[model samples]
Target chain A: MKKTLVIDGAPQNCALTRTPGGMRLLVGERSFDCALETLGDGRYRLRAGDVRRDVLLAQQGDQLWVHVDGRTHAIQRINPLDALAAGGRGGADSTLAPMPGTILTVQVKPGDAVKSGQILLTMESMKLEVTITAPHDGEIAEVLCAPGQSVPVKATLVRFAAKAEATP
Target chain B: MTPQPIRRLLVANRGEIAARILRTARARGITTAIVRHPDEEGGLAPRLADDCLTINGPTPVAAYLDVAEIVRVAREWGADAVHPGYGFLSENARLARALAEAGIRFVGPTPEVIELMGDKIRARNFVVERGFPVAPSAIEADDPATFAQRALAVGLPILIKPAAGGGGKGMRIVRDASVLEAELATARREGERYFGDGRLFVERYVERPRHIEVQVFGDSHGKVVHFGERECSVQRRFQKIIEETPSPVLTPEKRGAICEAAAGIARAAAYVGAGTVEFIYGAGGEFYFLEMNTRLQVEHPVTEMVTGFDLVAEQLRVCEGEALGYEQSEITAQGHSIELRICAEDPSQGFVPATGTIHLLREASGPGVRVDSGVHEGQRVGSDFDPLLSKVIVHGRDRREAIARARQALRDTALLGITTNTAYLDRVLAHPLFAAGDYSTAFLDEQAAALSGKDEPLPLDLLLAAAALSDRQMVDAATSVPAIYAAMGAWRN
Candidate 1:
């Protein structure tokens, strides 16, 4: 079986093959005779030959968190269909509230052209001001929120029109 | 007022501090109650308390800050005293006054003292009038029209801070005079937004300053004493992330001088209970009083570790009108101690706060190590409150061993399902400057690149393998075997 996992924002290919006695795991160019023993409660002991290491694991949706050697690493399992649906904007068709917050200001409106990285709006959450910016050069299709509006996480604040590709 | 024992205590805070206070209150045979916001139903503090009372407001943070609600809860819970811990209503005079009016003791200084030290401008003026060293500065309230000119005249590099600010919020450093005006406007806005006080103050920005603070305890009997200073120079966004006892930079003579100066300030204010006096020490060894916190400080654990004193117990004792039985000479500190604040933030991402459910929480434990944790497994971490999840404190015979233990403790800590600064703090401890004990308030800013951990490449293969094997679908697919092979169990080719 093969899987693609995004680690630290970069995708890596992994292949797993079952052997008579155990399992052989290949990640990128490295291979290991890996056997994982569950110690219960998100704890696992991984044995690769004579070397052994303890790891803690938890999963939320497609995101997997693994703690090894005192550091926690977040990895995402990439789904081909989800990637395809994201398209060029990478799923960023609208500015979403990063956390539960109240909008403090809006710098753009529908029909306004914005450059990449231009600040579109500002919101306050946890007593800290968060600025939402354009992911790429695009035209604003609609502004869904206004100043003093309260929003929850992932709430769409502004929608952008599809970027117009330049002719070569 | 006559001395009286607190029969019932209500902790008017949450998180580790509440747990910390409850530990002492319970140990002393005092009944304890803790306030819990609805969102914090699963938090560790409420679970530790003998009784739990619900507090409500529009937001979780607001609920904690609702002075009226907290007071009413304390009264209804039949608590004889209230411990505000730190932050929230810890420094709010209104809470103290309200608690006092209800005939319940506030486990801190008098409300008048809290109001005096709560205002930065008023506190600075008080310290200056008492003949304590202070930095040159200008207050916007003194003359709003000429505040800008006066601030510029003070020096080239000035720090604009909100009069009611702490925890590094609403503070800006203007090295270049050109940006002073703009920074002032931003500072004022932040001040108003965060603290509801737009009043501004500008002071001389000490270059390469070290933040050393003394923990002072006082009582109604007019007695005061000082705990050795804690060096909290390693700060981010104007808040201390790493703190240690017996500042490595101070000589014996300097330590005595600084500690005495702190005690002097406390004595001058007639301060009671637990309070911390902060000073900005320059490279030249000269120190200036920055501010005096009228409540217990967040970094009090480092001092407690070295002095072998339960500061909360001392606060309770003082609140009961008991004098500090021991004099400054009798109070002694031993060995070295260090504390690392485990915050749910990504240091690599400019320390922006991170949020997620704490799916697995294995706090570090071992000899010479203590973890004051407020989180538990399956608890959700959000930005509604401070990012601090816990503190990792280690004590050793010396600074070197303490540093080593701190590094080891960081490795032992395993908080999964949320991004934290544990690894970043480990890298910081590994820095040569930190290990050598040669640093200042600007150390983090100066060594930001080296401490960022970006230059170190992660072990992608190992991480990916771990992730893959732990994944349910991936593991199921990889481990599944043919029915024939399953039927031929125990037979190897």
Candidate 2:
């Protein structure tokens, strides 16, 4: 079975496929051939070129766990559509996506000084908002996107002219 | 006592809690040997342990909960004692008995104590039999006829709790009896799946009762003690989001009574360990025993600060053949303390766990402030574990002062690259009920909107701050600019 793992909230995707007698994986644009076998119990031994390592893994049903070096890591699986669980509903005043969700609300106009952490052009991905907030005390320098704009992660929502006190 | 002679210890758990306990152990000259999953290493255990052994192999069941594997590790590492943190085998009586049989000291209560308290129905019955106030509860028969009869008498809005489970799972409030039969069936199934005991119990849901839990310590010599109480009123989905000591609403008389009752329960159980007796105090000051956790709690640090005692140290001492440090009269409740769980979730959303890279991290600090964290900058936080990133604990001379100080600490805390509940915590600490000490388990569920203000219009200044930050990122990165095609020959020339 092949599984797609989204890393670091980035749009980039990683695919891990277990093959017969071997393993193939794709990370970003890179591809590699590897050997994978269950060491014992649930432990797996993965050998890829010069890198040979023994890994202990636990898949929390849907969540993923991988050990690299000596440190263990738990990478959670997030549905880009359920960001509203953070409690911020979709549809706050038209400026921001409200929560860290995919942009679903775009209510503000250009030169809208979204106070601080104010609603800017809203972006909703996993039900949470990328509702870009006012980064510092400032006036609305520019509005980069319009309402219903589905921007990718890190897409600029609005620009602010830094306030007098905001400058060091 | 020469500081209870230090020696090697085995921490039998995982995640942030295990990490926190190891830090405390290391500070006092105790060597730690952590049991690691075949694939699971690093975290707090690798750095904290002087020795390490892989358990059952790799799967969480194979590793963390594999009591046999854990016993083998302790024996191989020559660990004289094993400290079961919170989850997994922490409250497992059979595991505790196994450790005792293996001649290894279990840092929690005795196996017999674990068995008694681990059984929710029996525990409740025992406390009530001793004349302690237990929420009026009765088990509904599995038979639909008897269950319906029990449901009708129990009335609507009763809490159907699995007689054998904790963590608020296998629980539901049935406002309409029409669904009681199905609800009972579902609860029984879940209870059996989780706790292996599908016994269903009914309790009149005490709406708006503040979820207060008393920290109690007992010794092997049958000496039981109470160290005041913690207000863990702020929660969602029955999970604690914030906790504090010297509950805001407790008068000296009320506090004394509550603590006394908690100690009574511990004493009755012959409980010998660091444990918490959770109670639900009604609006009128009538408190009911929710249950007793016969192991160290997740929020034991706040009690440590208020009382100036390292509870785990006491646990270590007592387990290592020491006497109870103080009597009830000797121990005094001091100051005010609060703990905010820094979760890895976006509060504006439905508190869904947010997985992201911690690009920046600056925790709160100052006089009477303590932060127990598992992640730092460059740390990869995910939902694979509990969403609690760290617990920010603050202390002050009084509750009001503590409230103000907690707000300041929250304001000072800034965790970027991922959303956190820091702001929501500020709102909770500022809530009138919380400040007035009139909170309950229903406080969040009832006044969630007012406390969190998820809908209150975002002020313009706050909006501007967000815009400015996003704008600045664009100006600084230079990566936002479109790629310009350069004529290879001309550019090279």
Candidate 3:
């Protein structure tokens, strides 16, 4: 089976085949005979060649957090449907709340043209103020939240309409 | 005054400090009560305490900072003494005075001492008046009209700071005179915003200065002793990230001078309980009194490890009217200890605070290794409090062994599901300059590029295999066989 996973913000193609006592894993041009022993509680012992290391794993939706050695690598399996929706809407569609916070102010209304990196909203979380900015030059399609309204992580605060193509 | 044992203690704080104090209190056979905000109901501190009370405020941070609420809870809980661990109301004279008014012992210095040393300008003046070394500076409160002129006269490259500021907040270092006024205004504004006190002071900025502080304890019986010195020069944005005892740079002679100066200042103030006297050591070996912290410090464990003293226990004894019970000659330290602050921050991202649920936590432990952590597995780590999650402290016969052990401990630690500075700190420990103990307060800032290097790419196949095999859907798809094949069963055999 083939799968596309985003590792640390970069996408990679992977192939996996079940074999006797283990699995054959391929990434790019490299292959590995991988066997995993579940240690329970988000922990696994991975054996690949001469390397043997304990890996801890946790998942929230498609997002997976894997701890190997001393660092935790963030991985997410890309869903084709979600990618299609995002591509159809635009390169990057909306500004989502980075974390759970209360909206301090909204900078624009629907139909307002915004330049890339323009501040869209100001928010307060954990006593620190954060600013949400436009990812690309586009028109604001909708404002989903108001000042003083609390928001959860990943809550869409502002939606952007597809930018008009540049005139020749 | 004779010694009076405390029967019940109220820990008016949260996080690792609270847990640290509770451990000593329990060992000393004192009943303990802890305060927690509603948001921190599942925190580790409350779980360790004998009784927990929920304190309320407009926000979680406010709840912890609410002096009145903390005092009320302490009184209602029938706590005979209150230990304001550090930060929040730990240095608040109002809390100490209020507790004293209620006939409850405040496990710190008297309110007068707190108020005096809490203000930077007052503390500096006090030190100077008592023949202690202090850097030259100008105070806005002293003469607001001529403050700018006086600050410029002090010399070029002055640091404009709020008298009531700390933790690197509201400080502006002006190297050029042309922008001094603008930076001063900005500093004053920040001072007002962050500390709510516009009182500003300016001092000569010491280039490549090392921060060395002495841990001092005093009692009402008029006794003071020093626990050597701690070199906390490894800092980011004026906050110490790594701290150690017997500052590697200080020779025995210089060490004696600094420690004696620290003890002199504390004894003059008649300081009681545990306090730290911070000094700014210049390259020329001249040291100036920076300020005095009138409560326990975050890096006190390093001192405890080397000196074999329980600072919290000593604080309890001092507040209970007990003498230090030792002379200056009796206090001695051996070996070297290092402490690295494990914070929930992303060093690559300008050290901005990170928040997430701690899905998995494996604290470093072994011989000569200790982990003081306030976080537990499955607990949500939010920005409502300080980003410090824990401290990994290691001790060795010497500095080299301590560094090696600290690096190993960092590798041994695994705090998954959130971004932390564990890896960044490991890189710092690996730096040659750090290994040689040849660094100053600007170590992190100076070594930015070196420390921020991207980790060597690991085998992608292994990472992907781990991710894929652990994934439920992927594993099921890989393991499942066709229905026809299953139906065939063992027919082929």
CAPRI category for model 3: acceptable
Lowest summed lDDT across 10 adjacent residues in model 3 chain B is found at B484-493
Stretches of candidate 2 off by over 4 Å are A1-168, B1-6, B38-42, B56-58, B141-145, B452-493
The best-first sequence of candidates by TM-score reads 1, 3, 2
Superposed by TM-score, candidate 1 places the C-alpha of residue B444 at a distance from the truth, in angstroms, of 1.4
**Model 1 chain B: lowest-lDDT 10 consecutive positions:** B484-493
Q: What is every candidate's C-alpha DockQ against the true complex, given to 2 decimals?
A: 0.44, 0.02, 0.38
Model 2 lDDT tens row, B83-103:
998877898888888887888
Native-to-model Cα distance after best TM-score fit, residue B18 in candidate 3, in Å: 0.6
DockQ leaderboard ranking:
1, 3, 2
- lDDT ranking of the models: 1, 3, 2
What local lDDT score does residue A113 receive in model 2, on the 0 to 100 scale? 51
Question: Distance (Å) between predicted and true CA of B96, model 1?
Answer: 1.1
Residue-level lDDT of model 1, residues B303-335, one tens digit each, is: 989899999999998888877788788888889
When 2 and 3 are scored with lDDT, the better candidate is 3
Top DockQ: which candidate number? Answer: 1
